[model samples]
Target: MATFIIEGGHQLKGSIQPQGAKNEALQILCAVLLTPETVTIHNIPDIIDVNKLISLLEKLGVKIHKIGSGSYTFKADEVNMKYLESPEFKEDGKGLRGSIMIVGPLLARFGKGYIPKPGGDKIGRRRLDTHFEGFINLGAKFRYNREDHFYGVEADRLKGAYMLLDEASVTGTANIVMAAVLAEGTTTIYNAACEPYLQQLCKMLNRMGAKISGVGSNMLRIEGVDSLGGTDHKMLPDMIEIGSWIGLAAMTKSELTIKNVSWDDLGQIPDVFRKLGITIERKGEDIYIPAHKEGYEIQSYIDGSILTVADAPWPGFTPDLLSIVLVIATQARGAVLVHQKMFESRLFFVDKLIDMGAKIILCDPHRATVIGHDFKSSLKATTMTSPDIRAGVSLLIAALSAKGSSTIHNIEQIDRGYERIDERLRAIGAKITRVN
Candidate 1:
C-alpha cells in the first residue's frame, strides 16, 4: 500500500493543470467497444482506474495503441466474446464499477453482455438496476444469477422504446445511450443525467454517426442507427479536481491558478465556493484563486439561516466536491451544513477531520454541520487512512494546511482518480512525498 507523508503550513503558489475527467473517461473508454473502427481519445488521464479499464478492454481483444502521452487509438475489430464467460474475466470485471458499462456496447453490437457483481468505493449502495433496467427497456432480456452473483443481458435485436429513469444516474445514462445508438428505432430518455460528461458522450456519439438530441437537458432522443464508426474525442478537464484545487487554495491561504479549466462547462462550482467567500478570478479559460490572508467566511441564506450546501443532479452542486467543501469549511469564518443526499456513508470520513481538531458535527450519515475555526487554531496532523478517492484528496488538502506532518495511508485510493497527484502538488510548492 502507498502512503503520503505531507508537511503542512506551506503556502502553495503557481499554476497547476487538472487531469482529464475520470468519470467521463470511464464512459468514453467503454464506448470504444461500440465501433469496430479506430477511435482516438485525447487528454486521457493516467490514473489507476482508467488504466485498469484499458487493460480490461485489451483482454477482451480490443486493439489498443498508445499514440502519445495522454492519447490512445483503439480499434475493436475483433472482440473476444468468449472471454466474457470466463471465470477470470468475471473476477476482473467485478473489481471495477466502470466495467459494467462494457455490457452496454457489447450488447448493442454482439447481442449479448455479461458482468459479474461490479465493485467500487464502499461509499454506499450503488445499484446497477438503473443500467439493467435501461437495457431491458431497449428490448434486452436481463437476468441475475444469484449463485454466481452476475448480471447478463441478451437480445436477438434491440428495439428502442421510451424510458423514464427513476434517478438521473450519470453512468446509467451513458450505458443506455450506447445501447440505444444501434437499436432498431428511436429511443427517448426522460429524466436523464445531462452533466457535461453525458453531453460530451452524446457529441462523441454524434461524430461517430449516432443521432442524439438534447445534449444539455434531461430529455435525450437517440435515433437508432445501423452501426457506428470511429471519431476522436478529447475529455474536458476534471471539474472535481478543479473544485478541489479551489478549496486547497482557500484552506492553505495560497494564490494559485488552475489552467485550462473548461469554465463554461463547470456550472455552479465556482459560485458555490464563492458563497464561502473565496475570491475566484476568471482569466480567459483559467481560474485564479488569490491567497486569503484573512481566511474565508460562509455566507448565510437570505433569511439569515445557516448556509447549507447539498448535492443534487447536474447544474447543481456535485457530490464529489462536497468533501472538499467540508474540509475548507473547517477554516472558514462561519458555519455551514453539508448534506450528501446521494450516498449514505461518504460523510463518515468527517470523523478524521474531527480528530484533526476541527469543529464538526456529524448530524447523521447524510449531513454534517461544520463550525468554522476561523484559523484561530490550526489542524493538528495525525495518522489516518483514505476511505475513498474524493475523501482522500480532501484529507490531503486538510493535511497540507495542518500544523505538522501527517501520514495518510491507503493512498492507492487517491491514485485511482488523480494522476501523479504528488507530482502535481509538488509543482505548486506543496510538501508531499509518496512512500511505499
Candidate 2:
C-alpha cells in the first residue's frame, strides 16, 4: 500500500497546473468507437480510470497510440465490438462507472452491447435503468442476467426518438447522447446532465459532424447522422481542479495564479466564493489568488441571514466539488450549510475534518454546516485513508495546511482524478512524500 506523509503548516508558494478533465476524457475516449478513423485527443490525463478504459478499448481492437504527453490517437477500424462478452471485460466494466459509456457506441456500431453493473464511489443509488430505458425508447431490446449481474442489449438499428431521463445522471446522459448521435432520425434529450463534462462531449460530437444544439442547457437536440468522421479536439481545462486549487491556496495561505482556465465555463463559481469572502481576481485567461487570504467571511443574505451553499445540476454548484467547498468553508469565517443532495455518502468525510479540530455539524447524510475561520488551537496530526476522489483531495489539502505531520493512505483514490498531484503540490511548497 502507498501512503502520503505530509507535514503541514507551511504556506504553498509556487504555481501548479492540473491536467485535463477525467470525466470528459472517459467519454471522449469512448466516442472514438463511433468512428473507424484515427481520432486524436489532446491533454488526456494519465489516470488509472482512463488507463482502464483504454485497456478495454485496446482489448476490443481499438488501436491507440501515444502521440505525445497527454495526447492519444485512437483508430477503431476493424474493432471487435464483441469483446463486451468476455469475462475480463465484465470484471473491468463492473469496477468502473465510465465503462457504461460503451453501451452507446456499441449499440450504434454492432447493434448490441453488454455491460455489468457499473462500479464507482458507493455514494448512493446510481441506476442504469435510465440508460437502458433510453436505448429501449430508441427501439433496443434489453435483458438482465441476474446470475452474472450483467445487462445484454441489442437492436437492429437504433431509431432515435424523444428521451426524458429519470434524473440528470451524468454518465447516463452521456451514454444516451452518444447512442442518439448516430441513430436514425432526430433525438431530443430534456433535463439532461449538461455539465461542462457533457458539454465537451457534445461539442466533440458536433465537430465530428453530429448536429447537436443546446450545448450548455437542459434540452439538447441531436440530428442523428449516418456516420461520424474523425476530428482533432483538445479538452477544456478541469474546472474542479481549478476550484480545488482556489480552495487549497486560500486554506494554505498562499498566492497562486491558475492559468489556462476557461473563464466562460466557470459560471457562478467566483460569485459563489465571493459570498464566502474569498477575493478572486481575473486577468485574461488566468485567475490570481491572494496570499494569506484567511479572513474569508461568509456573507449574509439580502435579508441579513446566513448564506447557504448547495449543489444542483449545471449552472449551479457542482456536487463533485461540494466536499472541497465544505472543507474550505471550515476555514472561512461565519457559517454556511453545505448541502449535498446528489449523494448520501459525500458528507461522511466530515469525520476527518472534525478530527482536525475544525467545527463542523453533521446534520445528516446529505447536509452539514461548517462554522469556520476559528481554529481550535493546536491540531495534532493523525492518520487517514481516502474514501473517494473528491473527498480524498479535500483531505489532502486539509492535511497539507494542518499543523504537525499527517499520514494519508489509499492515495489511489486521489490519483483517479488529479494528475501527478504530489509533484504539483510539492512545486507549490507543499510538503508531501509518497512512501511504500
Candidate 3:
C-alpha cells in the first residue's frame, strides 16, 4: 500500500545504476537447494520477490547470512523439509511466480514437493504446462486439484532424459536444469528459454559442480553429478530495467549513466532499441544515455512498410517489455505495431494509455498499433494504477513525462523490476515521491 506521487516535465540529470536482475536472483536462490554447501550470491536486489524467496528458503531450513550490503551467504546444508502445502506456506509462496521453479529441484533432490497455485502479476494466463511437463519427462509425478488449486509433485531419483518443451519457458528451463543436474544420467533440453536469467542459473549450478553445456542456446545438456558444492556468484544486471531506463531517458530528455550493466549479455536490446531510433553508448561496462535524444521512427523491412516488435522465446524482444516499448513508441516519430504473441491478454493495459490521450489501436488480444503523439508534458494529470511489471514501469515513465503531478498506486508491481525506482529517479532529477 504505497503510492508514488510525481510532478512531471523535468529534464532529469545525473546517473543511475540498474539493480541485479530479480528474475535471475530467484532462479539462483532456488538453485541453492541443489547443494548442501554454502552458496554466496552477490548483487541481490532488495525487492519483495527476492525477499519472499529468501523467506521461503529460510522456512525450509536454509541458513542465510548477511555478508554485506546487497550480498548474502546461503547454506542449505540441512534441508529439513521438502513438502510445503499449508495455508501459511501457500500464502507466502503464492505471492510470487518464481516459487514454482522449486518443483523440479525439490523433486530431484528431495523426492517430493508440494506447491500451491503460484501467483505473481495479473497480466494474463500464466501457464505452468512447460514446467510440469518437463518434470513429468524427468520421471516426476504431478497432481493438481482444480477446486483447491494445489499442485503436488513426487519423483524418485529423476532419471536423465531428453525433453522437447512445448514452448521455451524461462522458469521452466531453470526448473528442469536444476532437476537434471542431480539426476542419474544425462539430460538434454531442446527449445529451452536461454535468457540471461537462465544463463545465470546454469553458471551457478556449474560453479556448484553441475556439468552443463550450451549455456545460452536453445539446446542444453546437463550431466548429472552426485552433489553440488558451494560457490559464489554475482547476478547480472536487469536488462529489462535497463531498457526501461533508456526509454525513460529518451522520452524525458534526460542524460544518465547506468552502472554495472553486463554489456556482453545484452545481446539484441541495443540493436532492437536502435531500430526505434534510440542510440546508446557503452563506456566500459556502464551505459551512457544522452539528453534530449532524438529517438528515431520505426524502420520498415524490405517486405512491408509496417514494423512490429514481437516477443519470441528469447533472443527476441522480451515479452516483459513489450508494454514499455509500446508506451515508448507513443512518443516516437512514427507508428509501430507490438505483437505480444506469448500472452494473449497482455495488451489490456493499452486502454489506460489511450485514456491518457495517446493514440493506440488494439488490433486484438495479441496485437496493438501505437502512433506517437510527440506530446509535450500537458497540464492535465490523472490517477493511474499499475497492472503488471512492464506496464507499471511504462506508466511510471508516462507520469514522469506528463504535465502535472499524478499518483500511481500499487507500485509494488513496478518494484519487481526497478529497484528503489523513486530513489534512483530522484538521483537523476526526477520529481517523484513515495508516500503511504
Identify the candidate with maximal TM-score: 1
Instruction: Tell me the tens digit of each residue's lDDT in model 1 across 245-279.
Output: 99999999999999999999999999999999899
List lDDT for all candidates, in order. Answer: 0.96, 0.86, 0.84
TM-score preference between candidates 1 and 3, better one: 1
| Full candidate order by TM-score, most accurate first | 1, 2, 3
After best superposition, candidate 1 residue 312: deviation in angstroms?
0.4
User: Which of 1 and 2 is ahead in lDDT?
Assistant: 1
lDDT of 1 at 250: 96
Question: Against the true structure, candidate 2 has what lDDT?
Answer: 0.86
Work out the TM-score per prediction: 0.99, 0.97, 0.96
For model 3, residues 2-88, the per-residue Cα lDDT tens digits are 899999878888778888888898899998888888899999998888888898989888999998988999888888563385667
Write one digit per residue (lDDT tens) for candidate 2, span 1-436.
7899999988887667767888888899999999998899999998888888999889999999998999999999988766777888888888888899998888987799889998888788877888889899888999999999999889988897987888888888899999999899989989899888899899998989899999889899989899999999898888889889988887787889898788898877878877877789998988888885435778889998778888988788988888888888887778999899988888898898899887889999999988885443434577999998999999998888789999999999988888888988888788999987
In candidate 3, stretches whose alpha carbon ends up further than 4 angstroms from where it belongs are 293-295, 376-380
Q: Judged by lDDT, which candidate is best?
A: 1
Candidate 1 least-lDDT 10 residues: 88-97
Q: Between the candidate structures 2 and 3, which one is better when assessed by lDDT?
A: 2
